[model samples]
Target: MGPFVRRYAMPLTFLGLFAAVWMVQALVLPPDARRAVIAWASTNLENLAVNPVGTMVASAFVAEGAQGVLLVVAAIGLFPVTRRFGNLRAVVLVAASHVLGTLISQGIALVRLQAGLLSESIRTIPDVGPSYVLCAALVAAFLYGHGRVRRLLALAGWCALVPVLLDGLLALEVAAVGHLVAMLAGGLIGGLLLLLERRRVAVPEKMAAEPVAGA
Candidate 1:
């Protein structure tokens, strides 16, 4: 695929899926059905314990109201990474960020509960959205982002996202805390990937320079 298409394919796919789901939610599903769908797609500690894999993937594709709009904007920021690294990495980065973010945040909640900082009722709080993965990828793209424009766009996203995360943390919301943790995870993962890429290239060069074992 061409560079432009390679970069855009994943985001386009996401947008297409988003449109389909939006329509389904708006036109087809009844209010109760819609609520049921949202519940099914949620990836809270309770839900993850039951259907860990399902909620992770399902949550990514399910966006509602303002979240859908925010997701589209985040996807736009993520396109540069997709173009540079291809779709597979884009998906992996987002998925890892969301999953790991969920795990860590939930873990924190558990600790808080044990310490009496949080209530047992909080354990079942439904947490679903693209914020974790979206923040991670967008920040990662910025970290490894090529060119001034792409980096700036990444920065713009950071400015917008970080405040929300901070607000969430300040408000003692698990979901917001998860988003912040996930964003950091994304940045760390992006940095590690860059290092790994460098090492990968260097290893081949080192091998070429080394004498053959048989020789």
Candidate 2:
């Protein structure tokens, strides 16, 4: 197509792959099987820790792995580089970040797995850790460095985590409404910050032609 199309193609493609994989896992894997797999992986090799041995689980694991690798590529894409470098960066960033996020997520999952093994009902608590670090890296590298696209994707990404955490909190019998409210609160704060950040980033050359200005 055009330069604009080419610029985003790699990112879009990897994202699609990542989504497909996660969707398969979420749609296919059984809860019990998923727990068992997580248990095995936690006590043994980190590599083996993926639970839920169904087709969907396989798809999700592969997708998460791909995302981890792609994240690093995306980070490198932030630097001043040739067109090839931009594409290369996109791939690496997506994969690397996904891996980091997975590792963080696994750490949290391990606790639940242990609970399962012990016949306890305890589950893991939510906090910003390795997974957040991975996500932060992806966002910072893209928004803080390259400063592109109004950072909506970054903000939305964080917001998405809220819903997942809300579901977890609800399962734990915490104030379910609180979790939802927390998401709303976070949404507001995150939105404001992104808006401020968007103000500071240079309007890229490619964006200059727009009739309506983009933040």
Candidate 3:
């Protein structure tokens, strides 16, 4: 039981729970509820669309999840990455982080810290998926990863294209806050993954030369 919990069950549990929650909250909200929420969010989205003011509180909340997941991914990619806490720890940590983020986001929304109705069509929508995505890039860079670092980076580079796509999708309309939240979450997650990995990864050439030169 202990072994199973640590090895496969933990990570699987975390990923599974996270995927389910995100699907329900971000992707699969009740249709009527989703439409209403989207309508409200789109308003603030427009206000920041053109002259872009600031990120919605919800985006910041989502950023927390991105941070948490990427942090764990970075840890996993650590060469000596220890599974000291086992898979349970990793699973719990990521799951808790995401859940906490959602709670915070909802709390803020309830309080109306967000932008209210914008022009006619402006709306705010939270796409919290980017957090996991950028973390996946980190997972690629250091760990066995899905592919090589270059490929992961190529994936990270997708952020650049996102704006263009959003532009087209919006008809050059504004969802500035919504996209800002996405970009901010994406950049932060990717940057941290790289930074943490760099700090931990050894400079093989440097280490090798140290011994040769000394000898």
Return the top candidate by TM-score: 1
- By TM-score, how accurate is candidate 3? 0.33
Residue-level lDDT of model 2, residues 1-215, one tens digit each, is 68765776665554455455456546777767545544433212233334323321232234223355444433343221213235554344433443343344444456546767422322322221123323433344434333344245444454555454346553443223233333343333334445654665556643775677564
Tens digit of lDDT per residue, candidate 3, span 1-215?
Answer: 87655465644443455455445556667767755543333224343354222233233223213444533443343211123223433333333333343333333443343455233332344433334323333333333233465445534544444554245333323233233333344344444544655665557655765756555
* Candidate 3 Cα misplacement greater than 4 A, ranges: 1-15, 18-30, 33-146, 149-165, 169-193, 200-215
Tell me the TM-score of each prediction against the true structure: 0.86, 0.36, 0.33
Name every residue pair that clashes in candidate 3: 41-123, 41-124, 42-122, 42-123, 42-124, 43-122, 43-123
Candidates' C-alpha lDDT: 0.76, 0.40, 0.38
lDDT minimum window of 10 residues, candidate 1:
67-76
Highest lDDT against the true fold, candidate: 1
Residue 198 of model 1: what lDDT? 86
Weakest 10 consecutive residues, lDDT, candidate 3? Answer: 77-86
Between prediction 2 and prediction 3, the one with superior lDDT is 2
**lDDT for 171 (candidate 1):** 60
With candidate 1 superimposed using the best TM-score fit, by how many Å does residue 106's alpha carbon deviate from the native?
Answer: 1.4
